[model samples]
Target: MIDIFLVPIALVVVLVMLHAWFGVGILKRGIIFTDLAIAQFAALGSAISLGYFHEEYFYILTLSFALLSAFLIAIASQREIKLEAFIGLLYVLGASGIMMVLSHSAEGMEHFKSLLASDILFTSPNDLYKSAIIYAFIALALWKILPKTKGFVRELLFFSLLALTVTSSVQLAGVLVVFVLLIAPAFVAISLELKKPLLYSFFFGWFFSIVAIIASYYFDLPTGYSIVFLGALLSSTIVLFSSKKNSAQN
Candidate 1:
């Protein structure tokens, strides 16, 4: 049992660490659904791969679509229209496109479920290693190159990196897990007013995710849904109490 969980736990930790920082940026920017939109595009790419090519070159296809979405979003950020509405439209477009692609397949519903919530319990070591390598480069670029850039260049780099992260993450953990990990930790950290919110986000995310994994193991629940449920539960509770506290203080 311990051996069975080791790789999944490690993968969850890596994902939380990489996504929590991005969550902070997204929260600050007030574009909370940006990751979800980009992730949907990646999922659309995966669905296309499943329906057409039997998983051949899926990663490249996913990354390409994600990057294209990122570029378009970055460009749209400069336009007069509301950015959040535009992003929401992108999300719907990717999602409906996925359904259309999978409409005729016998395993369409199964593929849809997996795309939304993959079986993280069966993640391989090679996937973890590849994700770690990609995240390392993203972290390096964010820390070094991003600070030097300005305006549209900075926005493009940020969203491009986010798209890349989501492409790999959706394959390993699925779209719902990716969205939860990207948003919940950051949301809770900000709600609680932690001095080092990113660090707190990491701890909060890892703790809840591990507990969810363990609980799923014991209860025979779906690992991905377990993580999402526990994450939403805890984050919502925190936000509720925090808001009440602020209301009382005022």
Candidate 2:
């Protein structure tokens, strides 16, 4: 009795919200590639699970690995090494390992496809519940840690957020959408001069994603592609309109 179309849309809303929040946090730390790398690592984790573990445990294993990867990224961010380099290293290593793992298994294609992009239509309420629980944990953990954590602790908080970001991104875009989820709304928020960029980005990303979800459902288009396109469009429109308004004020 569930409306399947609404499923993906609602899922996208939750995902975009988490993505925007974590995206902003990552940008604040000046680590553009961090989330993407962590996401790929998470995908690698999922591939391993699908290859070896019971199918029932695939998501749990994926999430755990993603959280662990996030912790690693946070630790790396605290180091003196340039973040992009560290991210590059992580992505390459994770991706290569995933490929190797998949190669050894009969379900390689399924895992590969899931890593490349997941079909949100197939996601069930149980999947949503699991995602919600993990996201809430990450959010609550971040809330507790961000304010209290000094230098390294702050990085840890961001790291937890990054892990959550990877989970959302993998579910929504597989591995590809991670960067878009991380960067687009953050880009929009930066141009707005908002008092609370984080909140603004969350709203904007969520709204934009929901719009795309609806659009895709109505038009029979690809949900992920539609969301990304709309997100980019809205971001561009906002930046352009803001610049024009500023110019007019001057």
Candidate 3:
């Protein structure tokens, strides 16, 4: 038997690491929608692949779609037009396309459920390890590139990191929870005003994730929702406390 709870817990950690690496870049570039956009695109990839291939193929296909979306978003961001509007457009198109594909091809509603909100109980240790490996390589690549690249090349690398992280997060945390994972730690890092933002971001991401995991197991709540809920609570508390501190200082 699989230790179902642990797998999602591990996945939550992987997602936090991913966001720490890429979320900072995406936020700096003013493309916060990148995570949500690619997550929908990932669902589209999985839906389309299910028509011809096994569900496992969704990972690679989703990765490809993520890269493609990132390139397009990068181009849009460089333009005068608002990228959020485009992101909104693409998000609906991707999600609707997936729904249509799944509806026509598959019989039951379970497939849609998986793509919409994943069941963490179904995740095995093997899946957690796989997610870890994927996140590790991508995180390593970003770490390696951040110092070496500069100018336009550096910008491009950040976009790539955003794409990779978004795709991997979609696979692990599904679309909804992934955005929380991307934003929570980044928000806390900013409010805390840490000297090394990236390192602090990673620390908080892991910290909140562990808390979320334990909460989920003990409460028997949905793992993804639990993670996001706890993260949101923590973030809110931090912001509230920070505001009080600022008021006192003033």
Best by TM-score: 1
TM-score of model number 2: 0.80
- What's the candidate order when arranged by decreasing TM-score? 1, 3, 2
Estimate, for each residue in 59-173, the C-alpha lDDT of model 1 and write its tens digit: 9989998998999999998787899999999999999999999998888889999889887888899988988999999999999999999899999999999999999999999
TM-score of 3: 0.82
lDDT of all predictions: 0.93, 0.74, 0.72
Better of 2 and 3 by lDDT: 2
The residue-by-residue lDDT of candidate 2 on 1-250, one tens digit each, is: 2487566666766776777777776677677777777888888777877777745677677778888877887787667888788888888988898988889787797768667656565568777877778777777876775777777777776776777657655865677655666678887887777888878887777777677766676787766666667777778887888864557668
Q: Which stretches of candidate 3 lie over 4 Å from their true place?
A: 1-6, 51-56, 105-108, 240-250
Cα lDDT tens digits for candidate 3, 121-240: 457777678767877787688767678987656666666677777776666567877777777778777667778877888888788777766666777777666666777788778877
Model 1: CA > 4 A from native: 245-250
Candidate 2 residue pairs in clash (backbone atoms < 3 Å)? none
Each model's TM-score?
A: 0.96, 0.80, 0.82
Better of 1 and 3 by TM-score: 1
lDDT of 2: 0.74
The TM-score obtained by model 1 is: 0.96
